[model samples]
Target: MSLKILDQLSQDFTQLLENSYDYNVVIEVGKQPNIKLYKAHSAILYQRSLYFRQKLTNATKKNNVIEFKIPNLSVQTFDIIIRYIYSGIVSLENFEAATIFDLLIDLNEFQFIELVERIQAYLLIIMLLGFHPSMIFNSDDFKTLQENAFIALLKQDDLQMEESEIWDKVILWGKARTPDLPSNLEVWTDENFKSLKATLQHCLPHIRYFQIPSEDVLKKIKPYHNILEKNIWDDILAKYLAPNVPIASLILPPRKKATVQLPSRKASIITPSSSIITLEHIAELSSWIDRRSKIYNTTEIPYEFKLLLRGSRDGFTVLKIDSTNEILGGYNLLIWKVPNGKYSERATTADSFIFSLKNRNQSILSRVKDESTAIVYGKISQGPIFGNGLGMGRRSKSISKEWYSSETVYEKPIRNIDAWFFIDEYEVFQICKI
Candidate 1:
């Protein structure tokens, strides 16, 4: 009994292989159940035999013809379809689902508009299965595919009538396509106007004449004179104007040049008073010292003068003199010591007087009675002196000349050797015998 059953199963499986169609034909069967039995048999037996023979011939040929082979079949669907050929059983889950978008792309390429429409209907079912409805339209190559489909549809006598009307029909057929189109006729009218304007600009020169006042004719005549009065308007007209001669040439306005004036040197100078030092005098003094210091390789004149002439924030002393020769409280007395054992107590008073004179002449020097050595003192003035010498004579020459000449010739009077005296409000005097 067991041997009989095994033999029967083996025969059944062999029959399945002999009757089974290729995977692509099995998929077609699931799509069209009402397909004629004779047609199905012819596709499996005669068509497959011819395909196999052509493939075998191409394999041997040096310049081989490319064959269109179907994509790989699903394993489950392949098994079910093979079983169905033998047992005539129909199974839903084991059948491969047809993708309408793939079919539409293929049908469009092959000039099969009827099949394309049928595939479009199948796409609605795919959408119900949670697939994106726009997947068919959103491909980067969709434009080329659509052009091929449109050309194929135009070739057929039945579909050629709907060639100009396909865009509207497709939009109405799909909810996804409808929303993307212009909502109303007015929007299309505006788009048409813009397109017409661009076309007129492009074709204006090519058009020789026109009986009607079309935009192309109007633009060719250059009727934008009123709008192009401004310079900016000319730029706008130049961008869109036809290459043909303009009706009227636009007049351009001239550009304005900006005027600028340099600052005056007179404004930089500070005006001076008769009683006070003039800026010109101060500038002359500064320039004179600068040139002299550079030539002499010495910065002493400016550095020393700046101490007294330039006021400090520490409240320095100054001597004020009225016309009566009476001195005011602003006298600044800087005292210095005579060398020890070199002079009497009274000599200190004479030395202080000499120190005052040093304020007037920076190189002033004095020697103690025939001594070879000398002590030098320096002086600076904030302002010009007014009067003459008090303790020393007016003819007393500066000690700087004696030192420069390398001689001890003294031609000035040596007066009182005891006290300090003011020669003027800004100068002091002293006496020595050497």
Candidate 2:
């Protein structure tokens, strides 16, 4: 029989963290007017984090104390991390979800694997609890997100924000990425517009351009029309003038709005066979298929989904896992046929498309730009292929074993980053009218 005294041990460590005079590490965090200096024992930090251990190993020591600066980190965020390093405890109940998410990303950077997992689980719970706020995109740190992450965020269809506000944020983010531009748009030259357009090349296609109101378009977007493709800008102008006239530019469906729904007294159950998707995803796919301007509710979906193939049950699979939660797939309007004694074959169709269903709420759709190569057929060993947008062949293998680049055969990239991902399980469903 064994007895554990973790509570007392934890308390002792907490007390030591609060009042230890023998501390030999000084960390300067944040910048000028908002800066702070934190004192801690190097032993605790060194043992708690691999990142700290590496830093301390290379850190110069003077007067028996190791000192370093983390100018980018906020004092409040570091405070929480430092305390957890000693006491192995953190209370997030008092903090907003955005604050907690920021902490989670910082913790991951410090290689605090266990704590990062815990924080991720907590954040997932919060999402399930339906506690979402637009504060993250509007935060001061919005410009600090990586291009890929920012693109993924923008692809979210259910963001609780106005299209105009999103356009403003996009412009802000684009300006941040392209430096040395004047604050005033009137002073901007053609070079300034070109630079910003290049920076936001992948981002521009995701915005629901047609969804923005005419007033907001004129007020918020008109000043930056030069940054957009000429055809897209022309289409925008044409749309407002003649709402019924069709244009060449793709008009993405309007984003979904969040609403509180009261559950019925009687229970209803509907389940789809696929493990990777849900009924709501089915509704989304149906809307895309029919070219609807708005998403349909699950109960309103008109297609009866029939399971055709299962990856796990069958032999269909991909290679290693990607760290991100991006799901890549394609829909081919034409039927797949094996090449007759040839190494490969190509099928053509304008309707075929590739997509990245990123992180559940976000999606990026890339339609076939070159109809001549909409689908590529290869041997069973090579795997199923969908043009250069999503394929397995020399091009896929030539890139780094861990990544794949878009060949631009599609109108845009499905996944923003040139990366390869694993498929734990995949299923094909045949959609039939009810």
Candidate 3:
């Protein structure tokens, strides 16, 4: 068909809808003077909107003009739906995120299944490609999504936003339900806490409270302490005071490193798919452990490890098993090989810390806790290096293979690794606020 013929058909059909010559139903949408009265054809309305079909099918009014009282729907969105019904076009221009969101919900209510799917795909593509998250996730103007929907989005491993920013948005969403919330929560009475808590009950459980730093917790969570349960606060303190927590207390999975734009963290065997603990972590730890060593500064990776790196040879190894939800990686921080009582090129550093974590009851796999009282700490000069605990209380044979591998041997000082592996699955992490 030519463009002119299609245009003429669209115009004729549109005029037929607009003229309302055979109109039998009056959709009395909205209320008061601002209310809209769309004079629509009963046959065409039934053909387009399933909702109209169903309602008109059950109509019992004696008068020729039947009225539908839909007070919840905005007249603007309704008008767009009407336009689509007549012209098969859903013009999305001049509409804010909030409006589009509202339209999505309204379409579902009207049983516009095809349009609903289209809108969902558009929003998903926009979010996945890293377009606008504010329109959908914002708290102030974000009124369209249901509680379950918002919670599901927050739980996304690759949600593209700063963890801190997510926290702020969540708070904004909670405050919406509790209008009386005060800016200064310090003065919030008991009633205020209750209101906020009720609003955020589902949201609180999903927050990765442990990932937030202790200082940030005090700054952000402190004011809302009234909303948190007492046991949560106690656990937060324990993690910070003693980082090498034997069992994981953090309930939520650590926010997966999302975008490369966010800040970096220490290299562990496991990290968000988008990230790996590059040499920067090792260099930082090295600088902290021994100020005498020159910081490693080169894009050239002198060493790379996939499965295992011999700890005695400055071997850097990282392995994360998704099947087991296990993550463990170690740096042979101060590897000094003395074959003939002569040290080879050593990867010496001031810091040596090994960390691990799992999806469930967090088990820590690290060195002994009190180095002074420990055997290796007293015998070795570079002692008290790795993480805490009385030698991660328990371990696994597979995960602890790095600690004491004789495949390559180092000097006597490097022989301080004591507690090795035990079971197939072990866990450990600094149960700290940060």
Candidate maximizing TM-score? 2
- Expressed as tens digits, the lDDT of each residue in 183-282 for candidate 2 is 9889999999999999999889888999999999999889999999999999999999999999999888887775433233121334566667777777
RMSD of 2: 22.3
Candidate 1 lDDT for residue 216? 34
Error of 1 at 362 (Å): 78
Per-residue C-alpha lDDT of model 3 across residues 181-252, encoded as one tens digit per residue: 788866888998898889989888777777777888877777777777788877776777786774345556
lDDT of 1 at 133: 23
| Tens digits of per-residue lDDT for model 1, 115-198 | 445444433333221122234444453333332232233222222212113333232332222233354534555444344334
Q: Is candidate 1 or candidate 3 better by lDDT?
A: 3
TM-score of candidate 2 on Cα atoms, chains taken together: 0.38
lDDT of 1: 0.28
Which 10 residues in a row give candidate 1 its minimum summed lDDT? 396-405
TM-score of 1: 0.14
Candidate 2 lDDT (Cα, 0 to 1): 0.70
Instruction: Name the runs in model 2 displaced over 4 angstroms.
Output: 130-365, 368-409, 413-434
